[model samples]
Target: MSMDLFSIARSGILAAQSQLGVTSNNIANVNTEGYHRQVAIQGTSTSMRLGNNFYGTGTYVQEVKRIYNDYAARELRIGQTGLSAAEASYTKLSELDQLFSQIGKAVPASLNDFFSGLNSLADLPSDLGIRGSVLNSASQLAQNLNQMQSHLSGQVQQTNDQIESITTRINEISKEMAQINLELMKTPGNDAQLLDKQDALIQELSQYAEVNVIPLENGARSIMLGSSFMLVSGEVAMTMGVTTGDPFPNEPELTYSLGGSELKADPAKLGGQLGALFDFRDNTLMPASHELGQLALGIADAFNEMQSQGFDLNGELGQPIFTDINDPVIAAGRVGAYSGNPGTASLSVNIDDVGALSGSSYELNYTSAGTYELKDMKTGAVTNLTLNGNTLEGANGFSINIDAGAMAAGDRFEIRPTANAAANIGVVMSDPKGIAAAAPKITAGTGNSGSTSVKLVSIDDRSAANFPVTDSELTFTLDTSVNPPTYEVFDVNGASLATGTAAGTPPQISAFGFTFEVDGSSGGSESFTFDLSFAPGDNTNAVAMAKLSDSKIMNNGKSTLGDVFEKTKLDIGSQTKSAQVRAGSAEAIYNQAYARVQSESGVNLDEEAANLMQFQQAYQASARIMTTANTLFDTLFSSVR
Candidate 1:
């Protein structure tokens, strides 16, 4: 009986000691992150039977269990992923929003100053000082655009850098996770510390990408990234890499490899920090940059067109006030060939009409021989275009000229007509005398006219072919005797060149790239003569250029230059605001989920202290039992002696 008592007390003392050790460990790691509170589970030992009566044989610790709820953990991970993405997007967009805000103020001011200078030039067309000032303002505007484009490009590069850094870290974490899994498999029983470290790494990894953790029977975790790619399986980890994108080298593409198989993953669908960066780059930053470039192209092209329509102070055809819209380098930069293309085919894009620019990128894919499909990146609208000779004219304000080798089927290109316009735009004309402030043609009344007047709107490309080499005159006569007024245009030798019936309202006539608007409300025979001479004092072209500030010559003649910038600013601002709201919501959810997880698994000092006292007292009681058992054995021995 004494032996039985000693054995029972020994078991009780062992169980109490285990419980005290677990409670002390919990107390020691109370502030440790990712440490789960542990408890010793006690179970009754086998019973002993004496004379058909059973007696308890004390207790033993079954296992040390970690307090954790898998469901709560999963919810916390989801919340963390969402919060990370939202915060990442908001941080980037807020920077952009601030940049545009500053740019929004500076650009419009410079634009207004440029236009004001043009207006001043219209007042004094021959003033050299005014011309120089106008040029100065124009230079300032161009510089502003160039600076803005530089900033946007820098943002793109910065995003790429961040993606690379995050991906590299993710790869390292994956490898570490695989090692941890291997260690877990080799470990004999549940190693609480190792499991804690595994969970800690998992939480850290979740900050970069969305992760799904699967528990294996061998006490190892198999992790997957966003439900598709397995980052870690058993003892193997997939390596993640970042590389330049196919079509746009400035952007980033994500790739992963497991064993010998390599595959590409879309960063936009990754649903974490990586996804946020890609989404902002493609959908927001790139689009905004394109819009800014479109504005620059529109302004430059319009001013250049006006310059071509008039004569300079030197009495020569006006030179380009800015760089040529079709400069070889600039044009070639507007399109990018996909790296996956098997063909050496290359193309150049030329802006045909600034007003028709969509301010968006288009995908040109070669489907078959001499066949292509153009897809609008913004709207997802596809248009089938067949190659006509060596050119493919896009309905959207641009034309693609095949420059080199032929393209094989499945070849692809990305055409961004205005993407580089802002960066490449410059004031090429430095001479003040090169400013075209005079009208190319002088209009005068010839014969007795009833209330009809004609004025030259603009001179087009055919003006050079139609105008005589020397100073000459063209006669335009309108005869109202016919049902619809008949108009005749005559050359310098009095020989009729062309005759036609004026059909449209407020009758107009177009000849040799010269469009003349005839206001004939008085209804009578009218004749006008156009003197093909340069008038340096004429400010007609300058006046027309000044009016361009209010012209709706962007977005298919729907927006002005200022309107485009404002629209871009508003778009970025709105997106930033939305991201902020989403971030707030995500944070709230994350906090709630974290609270639930901590409540279930977090260590409590008060509970641990109480447990320590209870186990200590139990230890004392079991020790007293041993002492009493020893005393009884001594007594029995003494009595027997």
Candidate 2:
């Protein structure tokens, strides 16, 4: 019937109009970011029966469906997060690498110059001009170390500032996300624009930290940061903040709070820009600072020890050429107490042997009364050390002394023996006469009838209980009446200090921190005596100090001063190279993921144009149906009239 025809034509027209509208919308928003292509779905309407024969009722639009793939979006987010982290790490590490590569050369050059000055002084021990030059070189080396330490400390502070700024932005984003969730819940139908805005915010948030999105039945979403902390839930958001860390005031820690309750976020799980900054500060920057400090400590302490065992131009015992290793301020800074400690315990660290230092930090935790455990921060090795009275001795190259109060069982302290050495090191001796260029003891033959000579090898320990005091003499007499030989040693007061058989390859005698070689091969009675007399022209101590440039006195006697600096440089270079490689790989992955997402959900102008033409043609065809049905209705009316 004409009536049925009119109804069918009307339905067809409505369906075509809907399709045309959808196509036009897609074309209009072709360049809009975060807009997904939409499609109008068509379905057949209910049929009509007349005389046992069914007839179609044309078509109607079912729904306008958004084109999106959740899986693809998730993969894109993951790729974005990885790329952000890699790039952040590479940027920071490259700066450090470049710093060490450029300014780092000054340290090695200064070290060489200092040793060269020492050699020049050794060639002419009594030259005041040479001594002054040596002192000048020494001062230059200290200044270089101080400058390097200042730069490294500045990097640490900059990193902390970045962390704080990022945290504030994250908190702002969290609040905005909460607002979006509330809007989604209040909205009745699916708001395509609102959903697009939500997704855009999520993508932005992923740059700072890892994010996990969860969909709710009420059309709202929940966002989790680092896959653990809930950043947004329904209408509420958690706040993130940074605070000064315990034990180390320069370090910063991340904190989370919600509804007045504080929560802790696992630092390792924060794998994005935030995580990269934290890693750089803790692993790369801090370790490099410590290594440089260790090198400074080794140099300063070695020279100071040599000075202590020699005499100056005025025949006085030499003082420290650099600041004292155990100065009160320096010692107290080596230990950091945890802020949560209930006891009033205070501790100080003293560098007992510079050569034995490992360039690592340690954690001291009290387990019981007068009992503690020391853990190496680098290697994670733990050692049990018991407090003997007020001191704990033999800790790597250092000793811990209780300065005041007692510690509770759960108290903890961070011990960093060499962390501040570079910053605190200085050239304390200004006078050229203070340089120790002569040996403390002078040896000679006491009316010997044999071809024998005495040469002082080294002063092993000046603090030995039986060591001779200053201005004292030691006498050595050899008796060949025995098969091999026998020796007797006596102090200045005619008291026998030691007696032993002088039987060796070259026949040497050791006593009271002094090793002397007595060659009695020309078979005759030999006698020698050594007196504590200052020889200003002697270059014995200067020669020994020059040898330190090549001496393996660091890293438990495995690395020299130069070796330590080179090793530190190599470590930073290696890390920078690794970060660059990782960043390249991440970029490749991110590009692939972005392409996939664009293909799946992104709008295409060409495709949308084609769809628009198809829908337009369909609209024209449906309009023709309406025209035909109207004409047929007019013809039926005329026939009836």
- TM-score for every candidate vs. truth? 0.88, 0.85
Alpha carbon lDDT at 575, candidate 1 = 96
Question: Given candidate 2, what's the lDDT at residue 351?
Answer: 91
**Candidate 2, pairs of clashing residues:** none
Q: lDDT of all the models against the reference?
A: 0.85, 0.85
Model 1 score (lDDT): 0.85
Instruction: Tell me the deviation in Å of residue 364 in model 1.
Output: 0.9
lDDT of 1 at 285: 93
Badly placed stretches (over 4 Å) of model 1 are: 441-473, 476-529
lDDT of 1 by residue, 1-641 (tens): 89889999999899999999999999999999999999899999999898989999889999999988999999988888899999999999999999999865677789999999999999999999999999999999999989999999999999989999999999888888899889888888888898888888888778788889999855689998887688898789888898778777777789988668778886756788988888999899999999999889988999998887777887665778888878999999989999889888889998889899878899999988767899998899998775767889655788898999988999999999988788988999999989999865545454555466665554554446556323567778787665467888887788888888776666667676566666654466777777646666889889999999999988988998889888999999999999999999999999999999988899978888899999999999999999999999999999999
Clashing pairs in 1: none
Q: Which of the numbered candidates is closest to the native, going by highest lDDT?
A: 1
